[model samples]
Structures are given as structure tokens and as C-alpha cells.
Target: MNIPDIWRGLTRSRLFWPVLTLVALAILNVVVAPNFFSIQVKDGHLFGSIIDILRNGAPTILVALGMTLVIATRGIDLSVGAIVAISGALACTIIADAPDGNNPGTVVFAVAVSLVFSLVLGSWNGLLVSVFGIQPIIATLILMTAGRGIAMLITEGQIITVSSAPYKVIGAGYWFGLPASIVIAGIMFAIAALFTRRTALGLLIESVGINPEASRLAGIRSRGIIWTVYVFSAVCAAIAGLMISSNVTAADANSAGLYIEMDAILAVVIGGTSLAGGRYSLTGSLIGAFVIQTLTTTVYTIGIAPEITLVFKALVVIAVCLLQSPVVQARMHRRKAAPPLPPVPSGTITTPVAAETAGVAS
Candidate 1:
């Protein structure tokens, strides 16, 4: 309620900057494209730039949601993109070769097969890092490099297109006046929120991330926690892959989910998860994914060059990152001769460094 308390609260809110950035982008889009905010009912489904952003960003949001937990476990998964490729490749291949790709049963079976494969791949990463004591980055890097090759082998270096109506519904179809992708992402987010907050898993993950030795001493199964996160991350990526390939009805082993890992990482960082790992905010990551998708939409709306669009997006991201950085904020406050803001409150689920410095780390 006091001035400093309010200031600290504002500064520590993980959702603040990402939400502000998203709103700013929306305004900018509206300025550039007056109809950007307009919503229309097409075949009983809502359609608009805003809806498109949510629909398109759903996969990234799903991936970032899983990455948030992985980072909270003091780890990362660079192979998400590759997993995406493999998932799509496997599913599409199976469907393509099916006697009736459009059969709902066939689509279901394909999806199941893809997810099972993703689980195995995720377990491989987990085994290397959790069981063999390999560093997370390096362990995941192995898969990151080789996963594409595996996908290529599965697809035989060809793009496999399918025409499964049920499969298409997973990505491009509309349901109940909204995008199916959005619905899927929302369900995934809700399940994650419940699995973590409504249970003790979230705390244990954070405890391990902050201090693995301490968590182990307390009898927490640190290895299992780490392995479970990796597996979950992979499964999330597989879902994203299904969404991507389903939207197009094609799987390109070379390009399916290409570079999505970087986008997911950026979304997580922008949403306030620290690469160093600890506490995390799935809400922030969700907003951050929207921010990214909105930025991409803005590029075309504002008539930015195709070649330089990435540069523009990168510059914006850099600016946002700098603005949200504590080091930069501290310097700005010092220049203004303002008292330093109080540290983020204990048990706050914002990011890593705040928790790390507040003795969350050993």
C-alpha cells in the first residue's frame, strides 16, 4: 500500500512488461491496420488479426509452458524443434501410408505413435542428464543435433503430406467459435498450472533448481524430477508439432518447427524466466508468446522488408529485455537518486536471480 511497496510490486510483476509490450504492439498494429482489432464470424468461428495471433502463437505458448518448468528445474531442452519435426514426420508418415488417412482412428493412432516416440526421445535426454550426470545443455544438444537426422530417416528426406480431416482439426480447425489450437493450448496451460500449483511438484522443481544438493538431502528424488521435466518438455513439443503439421497437412522434416526452440526460449526469457533457472511464471511465458506472435504480425502490417523483419524483431526484443533487466533498472534508479526498490518478496514465482539472491539457492 505504501509508495515503495507499490513500486517494488510493480517492478517484480512478471506479467507487467510482457503484457505492456503486447498492448503496445496491439495499438501499433491498430494504427497501421485499422481493422486489426476487428472480429468477424466466419462459419460460426471468430476470425481476426487478434484471433490469428493467438492461434498462431498457441504452439509457441505450449512449448514455452513446458520450457518454463524445465528451466525451473535448472535445465533446458534445445531439442524441442527436432522433436517437433520428428513428431510431425512420424504422424504424417503414418497417416500418409494408412489405407485411409482421413479415418479418425488412423489419425488417433498416428498421434499416439508420435507422442510415444517423443516420450522415448525425451527419456534419452533425461537419461543423459539425470542418470549419467551430463550437463543439461550438452545432453540436450546431442539430441538437438541428431534429432533432425532421425526425422529425415523417418521421412526419407521427403515432405509427407496427409489429408486426414481429424488430424487437420488439431491445428487448423475451429471449434465452438474459436480456434482448436487455442483451445488445445489453453487446456495444456491449465493442466500445467494445476499439476504444479495444485500439487507439490512446482515447489520441488524450484527447490531442486535452486539447490539440487539441498533438495536431495531433504530426500527429494532430484533425478526423477529432472527426468520428468525433460520428458514433459518433449511431449509439449510433440503437441506443438502436431499443431504445426496439422495446420498445413504436411510434414517437412527439414523445416517443421524449425527454429521454434529459439522463439520458445525468447518467450520464456521475455516472460521473466531466468536462464540460470529457479522460479518461473507460466503466465508470463504465455504473454511473452503472444508478444512474439504480435511482433511478427506487426512486421507485415507495418510493411517492413521481408529480409530485415527479423532484425527489427530482434531489436525490439533487445529493447524489451534491457528495459526489464534489473541491472539496467538499478542504474536508471541510481541516476534518478531514487532509493533502491525492495527485493522481490520471498516465495514469489517471478524468475531465478531474485530467488537465488534471496537465499533460495544454497
Candidate 2:
């Protein structure tokens, strides 16, 4: 495609900004550090420390996939992190309370209970948002605050430890030379892609996101779509909780998923979804998650204070937003329309749009 057509196509995609930003960041990293791309296997296990990032990032990617759907409908679920806390607590409690030495079904039972609880929490968000007309952020935040307390009640404000082998394997084991968490993330992405891209539901979601009232007038069950997304988001969070608990062999009532909602939200935004709603892309979200994971990994590798990573992350998010924004892109396009300036006084910008958005975040 020519520049204008390509620009328009990208503007139409949810993943465009995130992918472009990820490419730029990766290029910068490779330029600055020669060892950034090095990898080796040790002890029959892939030993590049970057693998650690991919492993840890899996859960957030899973959660983001569901969150993308929710946000697509002009809604947000602040309760997801809380749902993770709830799901982990419920799972750990069941495993701990299993019959002393013969709880062979502990894994099965715990997962079942966890799913049921997540479903109920999701339904609650949907009910308040749909049936009662509560704003999504308010509806989910109410649960977000209340859910943490519920998690503590389940665990009595304590972390729960377990020894179940299967439970541990779900989060800690691997298949086909990949970490289990990574594999689960892949499966979740595939399912999401199938639902959003291969089925008619994707169109419905985009329609509702673009214009819910119009969708209602056109005979779509907009409320049902809204409810389904919240439920799916909860289920995804539950899976993340399970993987998280499995990794540590324990679940912390207070910190299991603390503030992860922010990261997921950033991932969705970086992936290029409009906060106002509509056009969603799972591929973009996946790439966005990878970039976030990579940024975190890069910050750690460079020996910067870990705390500084958040600052870098915030900058990167801002950059991505500006790069993908129509306001910025429109200006970039205008630069092509103007005549090139001579190698002049070396201090003045020849293009106004570039000068306006170049250093400024959109």
C-alpha cells in the first residue's frame, strides 16, 4: 500500500500502534546492547533469562485478551485483578482442605469451584452494568474493592500452600519445550481469535462497541454481549490465578493480582484500541503484551532500578499512543504534503505538524 492507504489501514486497526511501537523499541534495544538477543540452553532447559519474562507475562496476556473484549464495548472491568485474588484464594482453600492424605480429586474440585466463583463475579458485573445501568468502571470497582475482602475471608487473611502435583504442573510444567504458562496463553489466544475473528460474534462486538444504541435498534442483544465479555474476563482471570498460584505453590490473599489491571489496561491501550470503544485486535494485544514483557525484561537486564521500569513503561505507553493516534498520524501525513526545507539555520523545524507532535505525546 502507498503511504496514505497504509496510514489509513493502520488507523483502522486496533493493533497498529502497539506493533509499530514494539518494532521501534526492539530496534532501539538491539542498537544499544549487543547481548540483548543472545540465547542459549543450559541443563536441557532453555536458559535465556528472557524466557522468564515470557513465562511470567503469560497470565497478563490471557487477562488482556478478555479485557480487550470488555473495553471494545465501551466498558472496563476494574474487578479483574480482584477476581484473580478471589479465584486463587478459592482454589488454594479447596486444595488445603482436601482430605488429609487421599484428596486425589483436589485439582478437579478446586478448579471447578474457582470457575463457578469467577462466573458469578462476572455475572454480577454484567448484572449491575446491564440490568441496573451502573457504569462499568463503577460496577467493577465496587467488586474490585469488595472482592479483595472476600478473598481474605476465604483464606482468613493468610496465604494458602498446597502440595498437589497436577495443580503445580498447570502453572509450572511445560509441553513441547515451552513453559506451561506460555502454552496456556497460546491456547487462550487461539480461542479468542477464533471467537473474535472466525465467528459472527466479533462483528457483533465491534457493532456494539461502535454504537450500542444503534445495535439495539438493529436487533442485537447488546446487553447479552456486554455480560458475556465480563464473564469471559473473569474466567480468564481465574485461569491466570491458577497459573500464578501454581508457580509459587501458594496464593497470597492480599497480593496475588495486585495492580495487574493497570498493566492489562495499558496493554489494551498500547495495542491501539480506542478508549471510547470499537475495533479490537487480539494479535495486537498479544504483541503489546510481548513488548511490555520485553520492556520489563530489558529494564531488569540493563541493571536499572526495577522501580525505574515503571517509569520507562509509562513513557513507552505514551509513545505508542501518540504514534497511533489520528491526530499525530494526520500531522505525520501533512509533513509529506509540505515542501522540504533547506539545510538552513539548523535550529528551525521546516514542518509544523512534525514540530507539534514529534516530542509531544498525543
Candidate 3:
């Protein structure tokens, strides 16, 4: 109803700090580059740094969205990056080997095969975690370690290139005056949000994350939920792989989606989703994805040395995490709520000892 109330409400929200950090990054970029926020229409499409950020960050956002759910169930998927590589490798390999790679039918078949492979990989991860009771990290690590090798085999230890016009549309094309990747990411985010929020699945996930044994006792089907999340995560990664490979029109088994799992995990953490599991936020992940992409752009825009870029990014992430920490927030709130020291009598100098004595007396 008033300023303090509104401020309090905002501070309590999970999205508050992430949104603030994104705005701060944007402001920093605009300060460095006057045209950072400028968007121009060209050939019926938007072109600008902002759009580029959205387009570039779309894959990470998709991965983070799925990772949010996986993490919500007290699980992690280190194999997502590998899945990304495998998906792209398989698709490109198939298309390159096809009789007519540019045909829509060939592209569709390749995509279907890639998606199906992703589903199998996801199921394997789920089986390890849900059925065998393996630790989530360990289960996914198995795939993470071997996934690239598998991809290499699929691509015959080389990069697979294709010339499918329809395939390129997935990553490099435009639709409705926006990047197609952005549209796809938006669709996936909306589907995830509605699927979880509109149904009882979200509550079940939180319940499982908070206490898996208790959830099982209450008949929450914890195993099924866990398995489903991993599958969904792999599928999301697969789609991201498609976009990445399609953008370049090639899939390099060794490099396709390299280290992307780290970025996705960082995005989820920055977006206010605890790696410890339980409640999550998709919108926060979206903002956090943009934050990461924008930060990367900032590094280039400001001309940071190549060797130091990673260190700089790490430092910024650390700062944001510290600011979002509960202890820091508590301290900040306490400081804000604490009454200001009664202004010292005008022009009166108080010795440190006298100030301490006065404070103790009060």
C-alpha cells in the first residue's frame, strides 16, 4: 500500500535480485556503448545488441529451464552438455549422409532421429538416478564423461556438416520479426511454466526435493518425477544442440555445446534456484540467462583480454551470488530496519570511548 510495503514485497521475491542484477548489467553496457539499447529494423527483422543477447542466450535459457526442474527434485544433470553434443552430432551426421540433405524431409528425419537418441540418453540418466538410486551427480557424470566419445563415434571422429536450409531456420532464421531461437525458447518456457504451475507437478517436485523419503511415504511417485525431469532436461539440451549445430551448419563432436552445462547451471543458480533443490523460478532463469549473455557481450564490448575474460566473469558471478545470499539479505534488512542513530547534537564531537559508553548506556 505504501513505499516500504512495496519495497519489502520486492525484496522478498525470488526474482528481485536477479532482475536488479540484469538491469545493472544493462546499465553498465549502455554506459560503455551508447548504442547498446538501440534496435533497428532491417529487412523486416530486429537487429541490435539486445536482440543478439536474447538470441545468443536462448539455448542457455532452455537448458536452465529444464535444469530448474531437475534441480528442484534434488538432482543435477552434468550430461546435458554431452547430450547437446550428441544430439547435434547425430543430426548432422544423418543429414550429411542423407541422399538429399537440403530436402525438408531429410532434415525432418535427421531431427527426429536426433530427438529420439536424446530421449534414450535421458532415459538412461533417469534409470541410473531413479531406478538404481545412484546419486544424481554421479549418474549424470557417467554420461558427461562418455557422451563426447559417443558423439565422436557418431561423427566418425570428425565434424559433420550439412546444407539443409530448413535446418538452418531453427537457429539462424527469423519469425514474426524475432529470432526463431528466441521464439522456440519462449515456447519452451511457456510450456514448462504452464505444465508445472497449472498442474500438481510443481508441488510434487518441491515436496520431493524438500524431502524425498517423506514424499515417497506420502505416495508422491518421487521416482517417476525424478525420471521425468532428467528426460525433459535431455530433451531441452537436444533442442539447444540442434540450434547450435544448425547455426553453424556443422557439428563438431569435440566442441559442440562445450562447457554449456556449466553455463546452464550458473544461470539456474543466478536465477534464484538453489542447487540444494525445492522451489524454482523460470522467469528468474530467463533473466539470469540474459545476464550471462549480456556479461559476455560486455566483456567484448569493453575489450577485456581473452585470457582474463573467464576470471572476470567468475568474479561478477561471485558478487551477484553474495548479494543474493540470505545472510547478506538479512543483514541488509536489519540495517534498513534499524533506527538511525539519533543525530549527534549539532557540532558536538563525541570521542570513541564516549560514543561507546553512550551507546552502552542507551
Best by lDDT: 1
User: Can you give the lDDT of residue 234 in candidate 2?
Assistant: 93
lDDT of 3 by residue, 207-278 (tens): 999999999999889999999999999999999999999999999989888888988888888889988889
For each candidate, give its TM-score against the true structure.
0.90, 0.86, 0.91
- lDDT, candidate 2, 1-362, per-residue tens: 68877867766565666666666666766777765567776545564545677898998898899899999999999998999989988988888888741255778889899999899999999999977989999999999999999999999988899888788877887677778899899998999899888999999999999999999999999999999999999999999999898889898979999988888888888877777889887777778788888788777666779768788888888888777788887676564556676566766666988688766954
* Candidate topping TM-score: 3
**Model 2 TM-score relative to the real fold:** 0.86
Candidate 3 residue pairs in clash (backbone atoms < 3 Å): none
Clashing pairs in 2: none
Q: Give the TM-score of candidate 3.
A: 0.91
Off by over 4 Å in 1: 1-8, 333-362
lDDT to native, each model: 0.91, 0.85, 0.90
Error of 1 at 147 (Å): 0.7
Scanning candidate 1 in windows of ten residues, the lowest lDDT window is 328-337
Clashing pairs in 1: none
**Residue runs of model 2 more than 4 Å from their true location after superposition:** 1-17, 24-45, 100-104, 335-362
